[model samples]
Target: MPELPEVETTRVGISPHIQGQTLHQVVVRDARLRWPVPTDLAANVEGKPLRRVVRRGKYLLFEFDHGAIIGHLGMTGSMRIVNHEEPPAYHDHVDLVFSGVTLRYRDPRRFGCILWQENPVMAHVLLASLGPEPLSDEFDVAHLLRACKGKKQAIKSLIMDGKQVVGVGNIYANEALFMAGIHPHRQAGRISAERLDRLVVCCKQVLSAAIKQGGTTLRDFVDSEGKPGYFKQQLQVYGRAGQACVTCDQHLTESRLGQRSTVYCKRCQR
Candidate 1:
């Protein structure tokens, strides 16, 4: 699934081509996605101009004059810019054709979505209860500390909870915890405020850096331009189990927390 950074990368990549441009057409090859694509989606956006393409967590918010299109790259979906005359492929589920360009969506798993929502989409149910973006000022040590209070859940699980702070996916959760020197399985409530501060900082740093790095592309994730991200090459712990820790010079350990693989250095993280 595309995380926050990858979504942001898509937003930035496509924004240049579609922003302020009038839509010439919309083609829906398949309406069956994670949720059925709204049948009237094309009619709502076809003649209007795109105002912006923004991202909230893993969802893309495509703002237009009349309404907005909100989509999610569920697990194996991607958007790319193609010439208006280019032919659609087998997995090309949707296309927003403009005067000179086309924004194409391809999802092999049919797990993505194309939904039309009224303007001001932030208040939609899918977005209403989401926590602050990890790179935003709204998320901080105090925020995470308050959210973690009275919880015996694993620290990694706590951070991965979307209601606590959106977009800390499995990979980022491991990286942030390792950067903070916090064991992934530590009880949430048992973590001290001081350590929570470290965790908060690391979350912001890691997330911002990942966004700059265009996300870690170990598998299906790629930037909107169809290029793989290089951040995975810099990972210190997420997938480095059985490898030596760069900081403590000890072997890193691997475990499963909340059914997600976790990598950490036992000697460095307590």
Candidate 2:
């Protein structure tokens, strides 16, 4: 799935083209996404000016005057800005047409969603319980330490929890833990406050770097320009299973945690 960085990159990439532009039309080729595309989406949003595009965790918000459209780029979904006259591809499931350009949503798996929200967006069911943004001041060391209290879940799982700290997905969690020298399976409450501080910093650093590099393109992720991310080249542990550890030259170990593949340098972590 497209994580925080990839979603943020898409938000940044499509903003300039659609912001302040009136929605000419909304074409939903398939309404059977993760959830049915809101039946009244086009009726409610067409002709309204799109105010801005923003990201919360892995969801993208297309803000307008009265409400917003929420989008999730599931395991293989992507958004791109293309010319208004461009033809839709086989996987192009939705298009938000504008005067001069079109914002296209393409997803092969149909696991993504495009929903409408008429209430306060933050209070919406999909977003109401989400944790603080990883790159924001709300995710400081003190906040993380407090959230970690009395929790026995693996530190990696804790960080990946959207309710604990949004947007620390599998890949970034591995990279951030490796950067902080924390083992992936360590109990959250057992970690020291000082180490938690380092982990917080590493999370922000890894996420910021990933966003700067256009996100990690493990498979289907791509920027609005349809370019793959470059951060995969900078990964230290996420997918380096059986590879020599860069720090100690020991073979990195791989395991399954929460059904997700985890790679770590045993000697370097813990």
Candidate 3:
């Protein structure tokens, strides 16, 4: 699935082309996505100018005059900008045609969603209750420490919780924990405030770096320009299960935490 960095990259990549352009049409080749595409999507958006594109968690918001369109790039979904006359690919499920270009949404798994929000988008069911954005000032160490209090869940699972801090997905979570030198299985409440502070900084560092590199492309994730991310090459432990640890030269270990693969260095991390 596309994480926060990938979603942010997509938002940045396509924003310039679509912003300020009026929606010419919305073509839905397949409405059976994670949720049914609204039957009146075109009627709702056509002729309205796209004000801006922003990302919250892993969802992309295309803002217009009266409301915004929310999109999620599910397991294998991606968005790209192309010429208006460009032929659609086999998996291109939706297209938002603009004046001179088309914003295409392609998904092989059909788990992505394209929905409309007529009210304050932040209060939408899918967005409500989400934690602060990881890169924002609201997600500092003080905030994380408060959220960890009285929680006995594994630190990995705690940080991955969308309600605790949004957009720390499996890949970034593993990398952040490794960078913070904190064991993934450590109890959240047991961690000292100082270490939690370090963890917060590491999360921001890892996520900011990932976004700078266009996001980690483990499988089908790509920016809105259809470009694969380069951050995978800099990974320290996420997928380096049996490889030697870069810091201590010890073999890294792997386990399943919350049904997600977690790789860590026993010597480097407590």
Residue pair clashes in candidate 1: none
Clashes of each: 0, 0, 0
Local distance difference test, each candidate:
0.88, 0.94, 0.93
Q: What ordering of candidates by lDDT runs from best to worst?
A: 2, 3, 1
Regions of candidate 1 where Cα sits further than 4 Å from its true position:
none
Model 1, 215-237: lDDT tens digits are: 88977977778898878888999
Q: Alpha carbon lDDT of residue 5, candidate 3? A: 90
Error of 3 at 227 (Å): 1.3
Off by over 4 Å in 2: none
Model 3, 1-270: lDDT tens digits are 789899998998999999999999999999999999999889999999999998889999999878899999999999999997889988999999998999999999999999999868788999999999999999988999899898899999999999999999999999999999999999999999999999999999999999999999898998888889999999999899999999999999999999999999999999
Residue-level lDDT tens digits of model 2 in 1-270: 789999999999999998999999999998889999998999999989999898889999999878899999999999999997789998999999999999999999999999999858887899999999999999988999899999999999999999989999999999999999999999999999999999999999999999999999888898999999999999999889999998999999999999999999989999
Point to the candidate with the largest lDDT: 2
